[model samples]
Target: MSTREEILGAAQRRLNLDPTSSMADIAAAAGIGRATLHRHFSGREDLLTEIGARSLDRWEERLDAARVGDVCSSDDADRLRATLVTLLGQYLEDSDDFGFALTDQFVLAEPTLTARGEALAEREIELFAAAQAAGVLRDDVSPRWISQACYGLLVAARDALRAGDVPRRDLDTVVASFFLHGAAAPGKPL
Candidate 1:
């Protein structure tokens, strides 16, 4: 691969392994000298900002490809369950950078994020509203809350994986199940 691609791939691996990995750590993993790494990335912040943008861009692309906007074609619950499993899979895969992207620094750096973020929020709200209308989802919370809760829970799950407490293979099933049914005993909703 090219030097930039090699560095980014190595850096992402380092970050996922340890979010606080140092530039020296990444350079070592990338198999490049510190000077070469610096020749490509002026500083750690510059590398991080670029990776955050790349992560956000990839995130948007994956969600867009999931076609969540047209998710009303079937039984809402079944479709939502399938959709979320796919989404959470992507979310977990990007655990390395998703946390940073949600931070203030990355949020402030990308002006386009606001518009895309608003659109995503609105789309999620619409889906939640539809599912609720279909009598699948509970009406206790607003669509906004449902969307935010899923994101919050996903982040928590990602952190748990980082801590080595959760098994990687079970992440998708566990996350999907929790989103579809949280704290509910068997067939009962709590």
Candidate 2:
């Protein structure tokens, strides 16, 4: 891997473990000297800004892969297609760093991170609106609220997996199921 990629990877891991970790700490974690780290990234904030941007960019890609524009076709069918399930499953499998940055107090407090969160929310709102218009999702609840709740569920499932409360293999299933059906049991009255 390139030095920059190595530093970002190491930063993601270290920041996830402790958002308050210093640049020196991250350098040590990355097995590089402070000067080398600084050469790649100006400082802690600069590195964090990049991390937040990269994670958000990844999620945007995932959202596109989920095919938000396919709401019409999905609603024309009786059930949601596998594309959504597959996309969400990938989110659960690969969004650990994204989740980590999102849940971190320090990261969330960053202005750039907050802006990224807003953009993410807007993207989700668009997706939800498309689905709701097609009758694939309920329109009674605000899309923004539902999106937030769904994300909360994803993060919760991620934490459960991290805490060993649930197996990693089950994380995707749990998140995807909750996103599609919420807490309603099969054949149970909602």
Which candidate should be chosen as best, given TM-score against the real structure? 2
Give the alpha carbon lDDT tens digit for every residue of 74-172 in model 1.
546778656766777887777545554554354546656656667666766776786776777888888789888887877778777778777988887
lDDT string, candidate 2, 1-190, tens digits? 3479888998899877777889999999999889999899988878888888887788878767766556434564333445446656776766576667767666678887788778877876776665676666788998888777777877887678778987887777777777878787789976
* lDDT of candidates 1 onward, in order: 0.73, 0.75
TM-score of each: 0.76, 0.82
Candidate 2 local Cα displacement, residue 154, angstroms: 2.0
**Model 1, residue 160: displacement in angstroms?**
2.4
Q: Model 2, 113: alpha-carbon shift in Å?
A: 3.9
Q: How many clashing pairs does model 1 include?
A: 0
Candidate 1 Cα misplacement greater than 4 A, ranges: 72-77, 96-119, 187-190
